[model samples]
Target chain A: MLRIEHFTKTYRSKVAVDDLTLHIAPGEICGFIGHNGAGKTTTLKACCGILQFDKGAITVNGHSILTDPIACKRDLAYIPDNPDLYEFLTGIQYLNFVADIYEVSKTDRNQRIAHYGNLLGMTEDLTLKISECSHGMKQKIALIAALIHKPRLILMDEPFVGLDPIASHQLKNVMAQHCAEGGAILFSTHVLEVAEKLCHKIAIIKGGKLVASGTMEDVRGQASLEQVFLDLEDTL
Target chain B: MIRTLVSLRFRALFTGLIVQRQKKNKSSKGTVILFAFLFLYVFAVVAGMMGFTFYSLAQPYHMLGLDWLYFSMAGLMGLGFAVLGSVFTTQNQLYDAKDNPLLLSMPIPPRIILLSRMIPLLAMNLLFGGLVIVPATVVYAIFVEFSIVGLLLQLLCLAGIAVLAQAISCLLGWLLHLLLSKLNKSLASVLYLVVFLGIYFYVYSQAGEILTAIVMESQQIASILSKWVWPLYAMGMGCLENGGLLLAFLGICAVCFAAVYAILSATFLRSATMSSVSRKRQKLNLKTSKTAPPVNAIVGKELRKFLGSPVYLTNLGVGLLMAAALTVAGVIFREDLLSAFSMIPGFTDLIPLLICAVLSFLISTMYISAPSVSLEGKNIWILKSLPVSGKDILNAKLLFHCRMTVPLCGICGFVLALAYG
Candidate 1:
C-alpha cells in the first residue's frame, strides 16, 4: 500500500535519512526498527507527505506523495510520537474535525468513533478539553482520531509509548484487524518483542541505512530481534 | 546564577519577537528594520500624547503656585500607567510561564526563580513609568521652573515611582491569576481584556475634561493630599527641592515595596504551581455528529481555533469589535457628528471618503491569515497529513477571516450611510 524508494533527507549539512528504500504491501504490518536519530521518522514523514525529502520518491496507493500529495494523503493517516493536538479542542471536537477533513459520512464516523473510543476506554473523557487530558489519554485520543476515517494505510511513530497496558493490547488487536481487513501499517517502535510478534515483515535500519529486512523469520533467523539489532549496531 | 537566568529570559523574549529561530525561516535584515520602525512609531505616538498633555498642565499649575501638585500628579500618573501596563505581563511571566515546570525541576529555589522573573518585569515597569515621568519632567523644566536640585529630585522620584508601580502590578497580577484559576480560560481572558480596553478608551475620551478639572480643583486636591495622602504631598514637595520630604517619601516607598516582596515570595511556590484543571468534566456522546465539505470543515476548524484562543481573538479581533462599536456610536450620535463635520470648512463633503479610510485602517489592523499558518506550531503535521491541499487550507482561513469581518463591515457601512447621508 505504501512504497518508498531512494529516500534521502538532509537538515542543512547533516544527512538525516540517506538513500533509504522500503515498502509495505496491503495486509502487511511492517515494523521499522532503528536507533535514536536513525532516520526512521524522516522516512515515515516523507512517506506521509509531511516533510519534503531532498532526494528520492515515495508513493502511497499508486499516487506520488510529492507530485499528487492530495490523493496520496487521502489514503493514509500519520500519528507522530508526541500527540501534540490542539489543546483548545475537546477530544470529540478534534475527532469530528478529522472526520470532516477525510469526508467521512456522519454515520460512518459515529460508528468508528464509538468503536475505537470504547476499545481505548476513552468515551467518557472525550468531552474533556484535550489540555486537561493525561499523556496516555491524549495518545488514545490520537489513536481514535486516526482510525475515524479508515484510511488505507497508517504510519505511526512510537505508537505504544504513552499507552496503558490494556490500551496497548487493544491497539495491537486493532493493528492486526486493520491489516486483516486489507489495510497496511508501517510503524516504528523500540519494543522488539511487540515488533517480533505483531509485524508480518521487519526492516532494521542503522544510521539511515536498512541493514536487515523481509519477513520476521528471514530477518531474525536463529536469533531474537533484540540481539540482531544490537549486533548490527555494534558492527556498524 | 540569577543574572544568567535573567539574561536568558531577555534573550528568549528577543528571539520570540524579532528573530525566527528556524534556519529555513531566518528573519531577514529587512524584516528586522521594519519591526524597528514599527516599534519607534508606536513609542512616538504614545510619547507625543504624554508630552502634549503634560505641557498643557505645566503652565497652569505653575501659574497657580501648585508645582507640588503638578509633580505629585505626574508621580501618580506614572504609577498608574506603569501598573496597568505591566500587571498582565507580570501575571503571565510569574505564574503561566511555559518554563516554570522546567525551571522548578532544576536545583533553583522558587524565590530565586521568582526574583529573576520579576527583574524583567521590573524593567518593563521602568520603561512604562519612565514614559510618563520623563515627559512630565521635561514639560516642568521647559514651561515651568528648572532647578538643578529639583531635576535630581524628580529623577529620584522617577526611580521610586517605578518600584511602587512594580509592587502594585505584582499584587494585582497575583490576584488576577488566582481569580482566573476559578473561571473559564477564554471567559476570564476576555473579561480582563474588556476591563483594560474600557479603562483605556474612557481615559482617552474624557482626557480633556479630566485635565480641566485637575487644574481647576488644584487647591482642594492639595488640601486633601496633605491631610489624608500626605506621602504623595511629600512626593510633590520633594520634586520641588524639599530634601527632608523627599527622603521620607522614598523611605515609605522602600518599606511598602519590601513588605509586598515578602508576601509575594512567601506564596510564590504554591501560587505558581496551582493547577488550572478546576473545571468539571462533561461526558462525550457523538450520536449527532455532522459532516461538511472538506473546505468548509477546514473553515469550521479554523473558527473553533480562533474563538478558543483568547490571545489570538483579543489581539487581532479588536478591529471587528471597534467596527461594530463605531457603527453603534455613529447611529446614536448621528446629528451631533454631522453638525460637527459641517462646522469644518470643506470637510462635510468628504465624510464618506473619511469613513471609508477609517474603516480600511481598522481592517488592516487584522492579519489573521498570516499568523494562522505559523500558529499551527507543533500540530502542523495534522494539516500536512490531511487530505486537504495547502491552497484549500489557506482559502479556508481567508474565508474564516471574511466571515468574521465582511458582515460586520457591511452593517457598519449601511448604518453609517444613513447616519451621514
Candidate 2:
C-alpha cells in the first residue's frame, strides 16, 4: 500500500499543493486529474522522492519516503510527463543499467526484458541508440524500462501524451495486467476519456486542493464523471 | 532588431554562466576576488605602457623605434583574444543549450539565433582585447609625446584590430564545424586534435618572430604593418606621426567593419539552416534478451547509453584514445622526449612516476563514467521509482565510471612502467 498524509508544497508565496491526503491499495489504478499548474506533477514528484515537500509524510509499505528514501524508492517506479532518457544510450543498454541498479537476477532481467520489450514492440530498437528513436519510441522505451524491475507501485505523469493510439492501447492493457497482478498504479493526465475509461478511482484537483476523489461510482453519485468534473471545475 | 537580439543574447549568456556557477557551488566572493586580481594586473600593464610612451616621446629618435613594441603587443593581444574566444564559444555553448528547451523552440530565425549566441563570443573577446590594448596605448601616448588627435587615432586602430581578429576566429570555427560534420567519429577526433596542435605550433612560431622584432627593428614594425593596406594600415596610420594617415586608417576601419558584418550575417543563416536540415529521425527495433546475464544486461544498457550520442561518446571515449595515442607516440618518439627530459635534472628520474600520475589523472578526469544519473535529465524519475535503493542506483553509475577508468589507467601505467624501465 502507498500512503500520502497531509502533503503540502509551497513555491515562495504560492501554495502549489495544499495539505492533501490519499492512499492506494494493491490492485488499484488511480487516475489523477488536474489543470495546468494544479500541482499534479509536484505531488507525484514528492511521492517519488524526486522533489522534497515542505510538509508531508509519504510512505510505501511502511517505509517513510523522507526517513528511508532508498527503501521507499525500492517499492516505486515513476515516469515523468516528458520522458528524457539518456539519448547517448541504446534501449538495451539503458535497460541493463536499470536492471543492475535494481539487482534483478540475470535470468529474471533477461526474461522480463524480453517480455516487456516484445510487448512494447521495442525488441529491434534495443540495439539502436536512443537518440535515433522518435518521441513515441523513446516513450515506449521508458515504459519498458520502468517495468523492468517490477516495483509494487508505479507513479506516472502524462505517460500517454506522445504515444500513438496503438501504443496507448497496449500500455492500457499493461496497466490492467499490472493491477490484476496486485501491483498499484497512480498516474496524472489531462485526457479525460482515458481517465474515465481506464481508472478504477479518480482524483480531481483544482487550485492546489483535491476537489474530489473516490471510485467512479462513489465520486459521481448519479452524474457522469465528465459532468461532475465540469461542475466542480466551474465552481472553482 | 540587432541591438535587442544582442541584449537578449547577453542576458542569456550571463544567466547560463550563473546557472553553471551555481551548480559548481561558486560564491560571489570568488567572483569578486577574480575581478580584483584582474583589475590590479590591468592597471600595472597600462602603467608600464604609459612609462614606455613617455620615454620614447622624450627622445624623437625613439619615436619610430617603439613601433615594433606596439606591433608585438597588438599581435600578442589578438592571439590571446582569439584563443579565449574559441575556447568559450566551442566548449560551453552547445552544452549550455542542452538544458534550455524553450530557446531551441523559439520562432526566431536560426541565423538570428546563432548570431545572438555569438554576441557573447564577441563581447568576451572585446573585453579581453581592451585589457591588453588600453594599457599599452596609454603608455605609448606618454612616451611618444603624440597629440590628442594621435592618441584617439591609436585607440581606434586598436579597436579595429580586435574586431578583425574576433571575426577571423569566428569564421574559422564555423568552417571547422562544417568540415568536421562530414567525418566519422574516430577521424573527427584525430582531425580536431591535429587542427588544435597545428594552431598551437603556428602561434609558438609567430611568438618567436614577434620577440625578435621587438629587439631588432622596433619602429619599422608599425610602418611595415601599416603598409599592408587593410586592418594593419588603420592601426599603423593611426599611430603614425602624420595626421593624414590617421584619417585614412579610420576610413579603412569603417569599411572593414561593414564587410565583417555582411559576411557574418550571410554565413550565420546558412549554418543554422544546415544544422536544422541535418537533424534526421531514425527507425529503431529494440530487442530484449531471452535470458539476461545478471550484470551484463544492465551493463549492456549503460554501454548503449554511452555510445548512443556522439557528443557523450566523444567526450568520454576520446580520453582513452588520446591516452593510447600519446603512449604509442611516446614510445615511437622516445629518443626525442627522453633527450629533452634528460636535460631537466630532477625530471629524468621521476619521468615514470610522472607519466603514471599524469595518465591516471587524465583518464579519470576526462572520461565521465558515472555522470549517468545527472545525464538522465527527466528520466531520473523512472530510475528513482524502480524497485531499487538509491545506493544501488548510485553504485551502478559508479561502476560504469570505474569500468572505463580502471582498465585505461592500468594500461597506461603498465606502458609507462615498461617504457621508463
Candidate 3:
C-alpha cells in the first residue's frame, strides 16, 4: 500500500504541487492524469524519494519515503519518463549490476533475467552496449531492470511514451499481472484511453491540486472517463 | 530570426554561468572584483615585459630590440593560445555537456549553436592575449620610438598572430580526433596519450632556449624573430616602418581562419550526426555457470563500465599505466633517487609502501565510482526504481572504486619493494 498526505512542493514563488492527498491499496493499478506541468511527475518523484516535498508525508508499505527512504525504496520501484541507463554497460551487465545491488540470488537473477529478457524481446540486445540501443530499446532495458527486483509497489512516470504497440500491450499485461499478484502500480499518463482500460483506480490533478480520485465509476458518475475528465477540466 | 537566436543563446550562456555561481554560493560582486584584479595583474605583466625589453634594447646595438619584441610576442601568443585551447576543449565540453540534451533539442541552428559556444572561447583567448601582447608592444614602442603608424601596424600584426595560433590549435585538435576515430577505440586512446606526451616533452625541451633569449637580449630576440620569422618580421617591420606587410599578414590570417572554420564546422556536424557503433559479439559455446562472488560481481560490473567508454577508461583508469611508466622512467633516469632514499636510515623500507598507498588513494578517488550513479544521466530513475536499498547501491559503487585501485596499488607496492630490497 502507498499513502500521501498534505504533500506540497514549491519552487521559488511557484507551487509546483499544492497540498495533495491520495492512497493506493495492494493489488491496485492507479493511473495519475494531468496536463503538462500539472505536477504528476513531481508527485511521483516525491513519492519515490527522488524529490523532497516541502510539507506532508509519503509512506511505502508503512515506511516513510523521507524518514526511512532506504527501507521505503527497498519495497518500491520507480521508472522515470526517460530511461537513461548507463550507456557504457551492455543490457545484461546493467541488469547484473542491479541484481548485485538488490542481492538477488544468482539462481533467481538468472531466471528472472531470462524471463523478462524474453518477454521484452531484449534477449538479443543484452550483449550490446546501451549506447548502441535505440530509444525504445533503452526503455525496455529500464523496464526489465526495474521489474527484475519485484518490489511490492511500482511508481512509473510517463512509462508508455516510447513503447511500440506490441510492447505496450505486453507491458499492460505485465502490469495487470503484477496487480493481480498483490503488487500495486502508480503510473502517470496523458493517454486517457489506456487509463480507462487498465487503471483499477484513477486520480486526476489540475494546477497541482487533486481534482478527482476514486474508482472510474465513482468519479465519472455514469459518464465515460473522457467525459468526466473533460467535465472536471471544464469546471476548472 | 538568426540575430534573435544568437542574442538569446548568448544571454542564456551568461545566465547559466551566473546561475551556477549562485548555486555554488559565490557572489557576482566577488567575481567582478576578481576579474578586475586579473586585468590589473595582466597590465602589470605587460608593462614589466616592455620595460625589460626597452632596457635591453637601450644598452647595445639596438639589435636586441627586435629579439626582445619577438620573444615577448611568441610567449604571449603561445600562452594565450594554450589557455584558449584548454578552456575550449576541456572546460567548455565538461560544463556545457552537463545540460546539453535540453539545449540541443531546441530549435536553434547548429551553426548558431556552435557560435554561441565559441563566444566564451573567444573572450578568454582575447583577454589573455591582450594582457601579454599589449605590455610587450608598449615597452617596445617606447624604446624604439615607434611612430603612430608603426604602433598600429604592430597591433594589427599581433592580432593576426594570435588568431592564427588559436586557429591552428583548434584545427590540430579536430584533425587528431578524426584520425583517432578511424582506429579501434582503445588503440585511439593509447595513441592520444602517446601523442600528448610526445608534444609535452618536445615543448619542455625548447623552454630553456626561449627563456634565456628573453632575459639576455630582448630587442635582439625580437629583431632575430622579426627578421627570420616571416609573419612576425612582416608585422613588426610594418609597424616600425609603415609598410604593406600588415595587410598581407591580416589577409593570411583571414584565409586560414576561414579554412579552419570550415573544416571544424563540417567535422562537428558529422560527429553530431553519426551514431556510435559497438563491436559485434560472437556467440559463446560455454555452458551456464554459477554467479561469481559479491565482490567479484561488483568489480566485474565496474570494470566493464569503466572499460566500455574509451574516454572515461583512458582518462581515469590509466593511472596504473601512468604509475608504471613513471616508476620505470625514474629507475632508468634517476638511480640517485633510490641511492639517496637508501641513506635515510629507517625510511628505506617504508618508501615503497608509502608510494603504493599514495598511488592507490589517488587512483581510487580520481575515477569516482559513486558519482557514476549520478552520471547515469536519465537512467538514474531505473536504478532508483530497483528494489535495492540505497546502502547496497552505494556499497556496490564504492566496492568498484576499491577493486580497481587496491590490486594495482598492491602490485606497485610489491614491485617497488622487490626492486629496492
lDDT of 3 by residue, B212-328 (tens): 665575656555675676565555555555357667766777787678667656655555444336446534211353456445565676677676666666667567666666567
Q: lDDT, candidate 1, residue B218?
A: 87
- Native contacts retained, all candidates in order: 0.88, 0.46, 0.44
The top-ranked prediction according to DockQ is: 1
* Candidate with more favorable, higher TM-score: 1 or 2: 1
* Superposition error at B397 for model 3 (Å): 4.6
Candidate order by decreasing lDDT: 1, 3, 2
TM-scores, each model vs. reference: 0.94, 0.76, 0.78
Query: TM-score of chain B, per candidate?
Result: 0.92, 0.67, 0.66
> For each predicted model, how many residue pairs clash, with residues at least 3 apart or on different chains?
0, 39, 22
Candidate 1 chain B worst ten-residue window by lDDT: B17-26
lDDT tens digits, residues B1-421, model 1? 9999999899888877776754437588899889989988987788778889998889888898999998888889999999989988899999999899999899998888988988888888888888898889988888877778788889999888888888899899999899878877667777778788988899889999999999898899989988998888999999988999999999988888788888988998889899888545676667767788888888888888888888888888888878988999998988898899889999999999989998888889877777999888888999999989999999999998898889999899888877786
Relative to the true interface, what fraction of contacts does candidate 2 keep? Answer: 0.46
In DockQ, how does model 1 score against the reference complex? Answer: 0.77
Candidate lDDT scores, in order, read 0.89, 0.69, 0.70
Worst 10 residues of 3 chain A by lDDT: A96-105
DockQ of each: 0.77, 0.41, 0.46
